[model samples]
Target: MAETLSNLFQQFLLYMQSGGFVMWPLLVLTIILWYAIGYRFHTLKRGSKKSVRVLIRKYLTGKRQKTKGLIDRAIVDAIEAVNGKCDGKRGREIIEDLFFPYYQDLKRYRKVISTIVMVAPLIGLLGTVIGMIETFDSLASMALFTQGGGIAAGISQALFTTQLGLVVAVPGLIMGRMLDNKANMMELELEQIKDILCAEKGLDNEI
Candidate 1:
């Protein structure tokens, strides 16, 4: 098992070397991108399978159970904000104030993910261009035939960076879109929760 792991590590090192210095930046970008993606996923999860109204009702009845997911926490806070006192516009404003952090949380790391997705491809393209330049320079100096792998090696490096860039970007784009959709849905649910709380004339009775 140790031998197998060693071989895998050796192969990974070789792969990184082939992609040249740009591989380091790409690797860093990949790390940051996925971290952001993971954070968004964690933040956006709906923890409970229950509908927003059901969760709100559960809390309003003084159940006050432990919460999970962004919406679940928001609902609990909203209930506490009113505490069977304020209602209508006043209650909504308070709820909104309470919810502001959640909205910000939903937005966290979204821009970082987006920026990395956009930049990864361009960075890869830059590597490709650099590789091509090196290859042509070798050819101009009549070293192409003398060099170990010559044009083929340089071309491989160029294409490898491009491939790695696309690999990093495509998934980030897809995941980013999915997370964005989830965030939007959660936002709407939050709005619905607010409206429900404010409109309920018998909120105190319910509690």
Candidate 2:
């Protein structure tokens, strides 16, 4: 088993080396994208809950000891405001001020994912162009069809880099889009929280 794995690793290195310098950047991008995806998934999953609306409603009424998330904390703040005990805002307004920006903070890494998606394909194209130039240079002396070295290596590098780039990009794009959708869904839920709280406290009048 160890030997088999070692052989596979060696083969992977050979392929990367063949793909030339572009492979390094592509690999780096792939790593960064995957890391971002993992972080997004972890954060969203940890933060998500079922029947959050109900939990929020209960908290707003009187059960306000345990704060589950931003919504609950907002509820606590809102209650303080209604009693005129808070710093100067209603409970709902307190929730709104903190949560509105908190949502924006949640969306931070998403743009990075988007940027990587747009850049990967261009990097692949760059690799393809370099490979083509190398191949053409080999063809200058009618050696492209005859030479087994530069001409063949250039074409191989071209194909390998292009393929690697697409391979890196496709999954990153898909994952980025999926994470974006999740973020949107979370925003919608947060909006509902705001609406419910505001209705309970007449927050527009408070502010």
Candidate 3:
């Protein structure tokens, strides 16, 4: 498996070289894109074993101050808000205020990932433009074309970069969306936990 993986990387490097200078930027973006994806996956995977509701209940009923992970932090905030018979609506607001920051934090790099997804193809297209210019320059010496048609080589390089751009982008975009969806689910779960805490804290159910 290691040998196969090494061979694949070698092949990819060859292709990148064929793509020219634009490939370097695309390469950088691709690296960032995958790094962001991997970070989100690792974060979500190593998240709380228990649900937000369970964590909230435990925190409220018991005495645990410090917390780790996204959901746990939100639950801690909500639990801390349970100041002896507080107004329900106000308690919910407090939870919301605390929860929103962490919710945003959980989705760290959401915009960065999206920007990379959108920009990668454009960069590839830029490569295509550059390739065309190079091809056109080569053609200026039209006398050489008849003897050794290098146009095919130019065209191949142009298309390869454009193709690679889309190839990198499609997966990144899809994975970004999936991560966004998961983040939305987590938001909903945190909200539910907030609601439960609010109910226990005060009489008004408006929150």
Candidate 4:
């Protein structure tokens, strides 16, 4: 086990050395993006699992009237504003007005995630280009006798950049897709919540 660990560490060290300085920043950005994706995932997961229906029912029926937090306050305001605009008619219009933005917000929550995922790969590509440039420059002044060594050094370093980019990009893309799905699922739930609320209020009387 220790031998395997040592071998992995040695390989990582070689990769870093071949990637040169630009790869370091890419590495840091990758770590930051990973943590951000994780954080967003946890937040979206919790958002999905939250009981918006019960909360709304409790507030609307007067079983729970206290404004406990920002989310609750938002819900109350939405319900009140919607109910008022509804002119106490208990129509679907009020429910639509109140929860459309909730659905929109769920969709928007993953917007930054896409940007982060896209940028990670581009950054990795940029690092690869920089590494290749350095490798070429080092090769230019080498003695003819050592031309093969120079070419090998340049090729190895060039490949390092590509590898680094993939290392960052692949995971970022995977996580981004996962988070996107979560956000989409949450939006679907919000829509369901909207439908339920509208029905409970008799707003769908037109249907």
Full ranking by TM-score: 1, 2, 3, 4
- Per-model TM against the reference: 0.89, 0.79, 0.74, 0.60
- Per-residue alpha-carbon lDDT of candidate 3 for residues 76-136, written as tens digits (9 for 90 to 100): 6567666653464466666677677767666888888999999999999988887777677
What tens digits encode model 2's per-residue C-alpha lDDT throughout 1-207? 999999999998988877788988999998988888887776554232646577666665766566555444544554555556323245555666657665865597888888888898889889888888888888886675544347887898799889988988899888888888877877776677667656665564443
Clashing pairs in 3: none
**TM-score: which candidate is best?**
1
Segments of candidate 1 deviating more than 4 angstroms: 84-89, 145-149, 201-207
Instruction: Write the residue-wise lDDT of candidate 4 on 32-134 in tens digits.
Output: 7777777666555432224778777876887655565334554576567656766445556666666666555555536565665667667666756665555
Error of 4 at 60 (Å): 10
Compared with the true structure, model 2 gives a TM-score of 0.79
Residue 159 CA displacement from its true place in model 2, Å: 1.0
Query: Where does candidate 1 clash, by residue pair?
Result: none
**Candidate 1's error at 165, in angstroms?**
0.3
* Sliding window of 10 residues with minimal summed lDDT for model 1: 198-207
Pick the winner on lDDT between candidates 1 and 2. Answer: 1
Per-residue accuracy of model 1 over 1-207 as CA lDDT, tens digit each: 999999999999989888888999999999999999999998898777899888888888877766778888888878877875566446666777889999999899999999999999999999899888878877877676434356766787799999999999999999999999999999999999987887663343323
